[model samples]
Target: MTEESPGAPGGGRPEDVRHRLVEVFGERVSASVPLAGLTTFRTGGAADWLLETSDPADIVAAVRVTRALDLPLTVFGGGSNVLVGDGGVRGLVVRVRHGAISAHGTSTVRADGGVTLNGLVRWAIQRGMAGLERWAGTPGTVGGAIYGNAHFDGLMVGDMVAEVGLVDRTGSILRVSGSEMAFGYDESRVQHTGEFVLWANFDVAAGDPAKLRAAARESLGFRKRTQPLAQASAGCVFQNPRVTDDSLSGGVPRTAGALIDGAGLKGCRVGGAVVSTIHGNFIVSDGAATSADVRTLIEHCRSAVVDRFGVLLREELVYVGVFG
Candidate 1:
C-alpha cells in the first residue's frame, strides 16, 4: 500500500538510508529505543528507529524522510489508550513532541499535537476559554484525544474542535474543519486513515475564569475519585457496550466497566494484568505485565461479559506491533 503512492521515492540500501537520516535529523534519531517507558501502559518492546521532535517542522521532515526512503513509519502521539506488543514496532517511529499552546483569539486556542489534554484544559481555563474544562483530567495528547474523540461525563473533545492540521502518509500537511474529520463516539477519520495530526485549533467561548477553574477542579476531582488514577493502565481498556435493554443496566447507561464488574471479573488477574478494582474497565499493569498477559486478561473479561449478558465489548485501545 505504501509503495503505490504517486511519486513514491525509490527504495534505498540500509546504509544509505541510515546515513541520509543521520545527516538530516542528527542526534534526535536513535535506533532500538525501548518504547515501554514512553507509553502509559509502560509495557512495550522497542522501536527500530525513534525520532523525537518537539517541532512540527521536525515531524514533517521525519515523515518526508521515511516516505522518501520507502520505510515503514508510525506516528506515535501521547501514547495513551494504546498497547504495544512485546515484538516491538518494525520501522521508523515519529514521536510527536510539539507542545506549544497559544490563543488565536479571545474565543479560540491553537495547540500542538503533543500537548496533553490535561494541559490543554488548564490552558483554556487560564485564558477564560469555556469548552474544554470537562476534560481537565483526561489523559493523552491533543492528537490522541482527537484520534479517539476523547470524552468525559457529557462532553467530548470533538465537540470543540474548530480545525486540524494533519500530515498525510505522503508528507503533505492538510488543514480541514472539524466536521470534515468524521468524528464519532471514540472514533475519527484519523483512525480509519493514517493521517497524523500535527496541531489543532479549538473553538471556545467567553467564560469567567473563576467559574471555569472551579469546574475544572470538580471534573478532575471526579476522575480521581472514580478511576484508578494512581495505577498504570492504558486509560479505559474497552469502550462502553451498546445495549438496548435498559433494565439490564439498571435503566442507565451501560458502560464496559459496569458490565465487566457485573460479570464478577474485577481483580481477576493473569500475571501482572489485573482488572482495576476501582474501575472494572481498566486493566492496570503492576510493573511486571506483558502484552500476552494483558491480552489474556482482556479476553477473559470479554468472554465473561458475553457469556453473562450477550453483549460484545469493543476495545478503545489501539495495539501496535505484533500481538501474540
Candidate 2:
C-alpha cells in the first residue's frame, strides 16, 4: 500500500486511504475512474475513488472506512437516473455489483439491491409472477427504483415491496417492512433517512406463464413507443402535478408530460440537452450534453409550464455531486 500523505485524516492522507481501499477491494477498486462509464448520461469527468463491491461485507467495510476517514461517501446503483458533474466526485463512490435474484416462495421474490429492474422483471416473468410486469421497461437497479419510488399507470414499485434491508450511517443493518417504509408518489422515506438499501423482498401474484410473458412484452413495447429509450436520460425529469378530486371523475389524472406537450415545450433544447420529441418529459443528452445543459433545460421546461398552465412542476430525478 502507498504511504500516507502528510497532514491527512485517520492517520493517513487521502491518497493513502485510497490505496488502502484499493488493497482491500483488490481488482474492484479503481482510481480516477471515469464517471461517464458509471452513469447513463455518459458525460461526466472521473471520480477520485470508485470502489465496486460484489459482496455485502465489502460494502459495509467501504462505508465504514470512508466514514472513519471523514471522506464523503456516495452510493451508486445502476446509474440510470443520475447526472454526475464534469468536475467529478471528490469522495468515495461505492457501486453495488452483488446482483442476485431468488424466488422466496410462489408469491415472493428476493433480490439484491444491485439487481437491475429489467433483470428482476425477467426473473419474475420466468416464474409466472404478475405484479412487476408493469416495470418491465424501466432501467436502473432495484434499489434505485425503490429509492425513487418509480411508478407507471398509477402503480408503484413500493406497492410490491414487502421488506427492505438497509445499511445505516453507522454501518448497522436494519430490515424494514413495507408499512414502515412510508412511500409517497415518486418519493420514499429512505431518501430523507439516508439509508443504503442492500436487498429487498417483493410480494407478487401468480399468473399464467404465457400471459405474464405477453404482459412483459406489451409493457416494454409501450415504453419503446412512448419513451426515448435509445437516448441518454434519467427517465422522467419532472413529477406530474396532482389533479383535483373533481378532475378524476371525468378522466385520468393530468401528467407533467401531457402538460408539457400541451404547453408546446416539446423539442425544447438548452445546449446539447433537448426535451425528447418522442417523450416530452424526458430530457436527452445528445453526445456532449453537460450537467449545466440538463439543468437549464429542466428550468426552462418548468418555467414554460408554469407560465402557460399555472402549475409548478417538481423534479423526479435526484441531482447529485455539484448540481445538487
Candidate 3:
C-alpha cells in the first residue's frame, strides 16, 4: 500500500501521517527520531514517524491506524539482527516493549513478545525451568526470536514453542500452533505473512535452578570467548553454509566463520567497518562506521568467499528501510 493520499497535493504530507498517529498514540508517536540507538549495530538514520509502546493492544491499534492512513508499518523488537538504512525509514516504525511473563501450572511458560530472550532464559531458570537456559546470551526479543526461529547449539526457539498469538497485517489477531509457523533455518511464517507476534507459550520441563544457571553462565562464557561481544556488530554476519561437497571444505570446519577464515578475509576492512579477527563471521564497527560502510564490507566478504570457494553465503542479518 502507498502512504499517500490521492486527494492531497504532492503525494501526502508528513504532517498528515503524524497527525493520524498522534490521534491514536498521543505523545507516544514521534517524528524524525534517530534509530541507531535502538539497534545492536548502532548505525542508521532516523524514522520519519515512530511509535514506542508496551501494550499489545497498541500494536494492533497501530496497525489499524497506519492502514487507515495508507502508511507502511515496521515493527522493531530489541533491535538485534537488523541493519537499518542510513537514509532512514518512511511511515510508522513501532517498537514493541511489552515484556510481561508468567508460568502456567508446572511446565508451560507464557511471555510477551517484547521480553528479551536472555531475560526469558533467566526467568525460566529462576523457576527451575529447563528448556530456555541454554539460550542465555541470545539477543533480541521473544517476538524477533520467534520470527526467525532463533537457534543456538542446534536447538531452535521454535522447537520449544507450544503456540503463538499473532496479529496479521490486517489487524487481526489469531493463535497458531507451533507447527503452523513453518520454521526452518533462519526462516518463519511471519517473515512471509508480515504478521506480528503478541505473545508465546513455551513448553518447558522442570529442572534444578542451580544447574540451569550454570548452563546459562557457560553459554555466556562461550559467547564472550568466541564472539566479538565487545565490538558494535549485528552478531554473526553470515549463516553457516550447508556442506554439499565433502571435498570442498578441504579440512576446515563446515561453518561460515571457518570458510571466511580459510578465505583469508579476516580483518578485511571497508571504511570504518572491519571483519572481526576474533570471529571471522562478524563485521565490527570502529564507532565511526556508517550503514553504507557495513553493507559494502559485507559484500566484499561474500565476494571473497565466492571467489575462493564456490559456496555462496547467506546472511542472517535483516536489512530495514532503504539503502543509499
Candidate 4:
C-alpha cells in the first residue's frame, strides 16, 4: 500500500482530488456524497469524492489519474456488504455501474462486474443455464462475488468462473483463470490483494429452463427464511472457522451463526447495533446505529465466541475510512 504524502498534490488533499476527479469525470463526480444512501446499512457519513462510472474506460481513466495523483482509491460495487465509517472516506470512491450480461453459448455467459448476482442468476436461468441457479438470491455484484469467493452448498463462485478480467494496481487489464487464483472460504486472492475486477466469464451447464428457475426460486426462498434480508446487514459477519480432522463432527466446524447463538449473544446490542435475533451471525443497524456501534458489537461477539468456544472469528465485510 502507498502511504499518503503530506506535500504531494492531492495527497491528503480532498479538495484537489475532488477537483481532478470532476475534471476527469465531468458531471459524474460529487463531493461530500452521503455514503448512507449508497450502502445497505444506510448508516455511514459522506465521502470526500464519489465518482460513478458506467463505462469501463471511465473507470480505467479515473484509476490512472488517482494513481498518478497518489490518491487513495476505494472501489464500490452493490454496496451490499460494506461498512463505511461515520467520519467518511477521504480519497476517491469509484462506483461501478457497468451492468451488462451476454450469453456466449448454451453454457457460457459473460457479465460486467457491476451486474448483481441475482440478476446474473436470473439471466442464466432464463437462458436455461444450470450452474448459477443455485446462487439466485446471493447479494452483491458479479465482481464482488468472484472476489469474495461467495459460495453455496459446498460450491464457490469461483467454481463456475472460467476467466476473470482484472485491472491491476498499474491499470493493466488481464484475464486469469479461476484455478490459478487462490480461493478459500469467503475470500479470494484477488480480494485480499485489492485487484480491481472488471468482468467474469462463467462456464455454466445446460438444463431445462423450468428446472433451473425452480432451483433458483428454492434457493431464494431458503435465503429469505434463514437470513435477515428484511433488515440492514452485510450478510454473515464472520467466516466459519476452518475445520480440522480432529475436530467435532469428524472435521467439520459448526457454522459461525450457530456458535454465536449457542454462546448466548443473539439479539445482543451495543448502542443501536445488534446481532440479529433471527440470525446470530448477522449484525444489523437500527436507525441510529453508527460505524462505531457496529464495530463494538463485532468486537463483543468476537470476544464472547473466543471465551466460550476458543474460536476466533474473522470479519466478512471490509471496513473503509476512519471510524473515529
- The candidate that achieves the highest TM-score relative to the unseen native structure: 3
From the highest lDDT down, the ranking of the candidates is: 3, 1, 4, 2
Clashes per model (N, Cα, C within 3 A): 0, 0, 0, 0
- RMSD (Å) of each candidate, 1 decimal: 4.1, 4.0, 2.9, 3.1
Task: Put down candidate 1 lDDT per residue, 12-51, tens digits, no spaces.
Answer: 6656766777888998788778898889899977877788
**Ten-residue stretch with the least lDDT total in model 4:** 1-10
Residue 86 lDDT in model 1?
84
- Using TM-score as the measure, name the better of candidate 1 and candidate 2: 1
Question: Which of candidates 1 and 3 reaches a greater lDDT?
Answer: 3
Native-to-model Cα distance after best TM-score fit, residue 263 in candidate 3, in Å: 1.0
Taken over the whole model, the C-alpha lDDT of each candidate is 0.83, 0.80, 0.86, 0.80
The C-alpha local distance difference test score for the whole of candidate 2 amounts to 0.80
> Judged by TM-score relative to the true structure, which candidate is superior, 1 or 3?
3
Model 1 C-alpha lDDT versus the unseen true structure = 0.83
TM-score of each: 0.92, 0.90, 0.94, 0.92
lDDT-superior candidate, 1 or 2: 1
Give every collision pair in model 2: none
Question: Considering TM-score, where higher is better, how would the candidates rank from best to worst?
Answer: 3, 4, 1, 2
For model 4, residues 14-132, the per-residue Cα lDDT tens digits are 55655676678888787668888788887777766788765666667866887878877788888877899887776778888657899887778999888888888888888788898
